[model samples]
Target: MDNETLQAWVEQVSRDSFGRPFLHQATFNRRLRSTGGRYFMRSHDIEINPKQLETFGREETEKIIKHELCHYHLHLTKRGYRHQDADFQRLLAEVGGSRYCSALPGQTKRVQPYRYKLVCRSCGMEYLRKRKVNPAKYACGKCRGKLFIKMLDFVLEP
Candidate 1:
């Protein structure tokens, strides 16, 4: 749950699974949202997503830690450490690590609404846009006429 316990667990997993000692630090990274864990190539440190533990519990989190450890051990030994590499894949399978982490519920990216619209005054052509743009910087493609921007109103229906 905490950093210290995570560090000890990572070291233990490294030794038990890979027969290699994990010398680097392992900490719970609160900022990690999309992935279960990350391995730093430069620092050789491992970061576990705390949300994974809270969501999936210890069993799934341990697999994520093993996944990171695969990268750690292979990279340090000058072996194939990337996801596509044969060595990494073999090691991962041998350790029974998870190939991909599951996405957290309600973590999907929000779709941006079309908040603005560009209108051609001459041709009455319109373009829906998600971001606001300067009307002076753009021209209407249909008639090469002047363009004006308007804010679109959203009406929520029951």
Candidate 2:
């Protein structure tokens, strides 16, 4: 979703879940990598990762919004807002918000390192491998066919 829709979503989520209004802006930052969302302390604006909705869909993104809102509302109310804070954790659990921003498997945006991949043409199976492999050295476990490798785009989620 674009920034406009993202703003509306954030507003709705704030009121519906927290019973509070989000006066600051909510935007989508394409350059945001690794984290699911960012809550700006200076501007009090919320920035969400666009790839999140495109990859994981609305359900996951909403959870992310709830996660960010925990920070926003808590910070505004002068409560413990940091991830390590007790109030933040309690509110997040009560609201059923995501504990952490989830990273897509095999995506380069992942904080966890991914070293390789293996694809089986015969069975059309794609695998995320943690270490590099020689293509011709091994065959598909299921059909004994050659394997191909690809670098992930770090776009959509599984």
Candidate 3:
């Protein structure tokens, strides 16, 4: 949807859910990623991730609008607006807003296993590392000795 439609939707949601009018702008922000929406504290504007609508459709996108509204309303009223605040959490739960702003598809973070080890030449002390490191830049903590880096073979468990 366009900015005008988003603005009207946000206003309607605010009035229906929070019993308040949203005076600021609401727009589709193409740059938004990971999070479904964002509420600007300073401008009091709400930005929805356009990708959310494309992926999840209107029903889910409405929930995201509610989530951002919770932040907008709570912050404007000088109440607990942060996600950790009781007021924010209670309002969000009461309105049935999404717990999280829903991650975009294919945007989840990946975990990398340790593939290298730093071994102290003198003491044989070893430190597992996820990335390659220059041994010359670091010294062994136990004996302050020169360290050498070695690749480790990892076997996946069945």
What is the number of residue pairs that collide in model 3?
0
Better of 1 and 3 by TM-score: 3
Candidate that beats the other on lDDT, 2 or 3, i.e. the better one:
3
Give a tens-digit lDDT track for model 2, residues 25-139. 9998889778899899889999888888888899999999999999999999999999999999999999989998778656664355555678887996777766677788888
Deviation in Å, model 2, residue 47 alpha carbon: 0.5
lDDT per residue as tens, model 1, 49-131: 99999998999999999999999999999999999999999999999999999889889876677888899999999988888
Report clash pairs, candidate 2.
none
TM-score of candidate 3 versus the correct structure, residues matched by position: 0.77
Q: In model 3, where do residues sit more than 4 Å from their true spots?
A: 110-117, 130-158
In model 1, the runs with Cα more than 4 Å from the true position are 110-158
Predicted structure 2, TM vs. truth: 0.67
Task: Summing lDDT over every window of 10 consecutive residues in candidate 1, give the lowest-scoring window.
Answer: 149-158
Candidate 2: where is the Cα deviation over 4 Å? 108-158
Model 3 over residues 79-132: C-alpha lDDT tens digits? 999989999999999998997866777996766777888999999999888878
For candidate 1, the per-residue lDDT at 31 reads 98
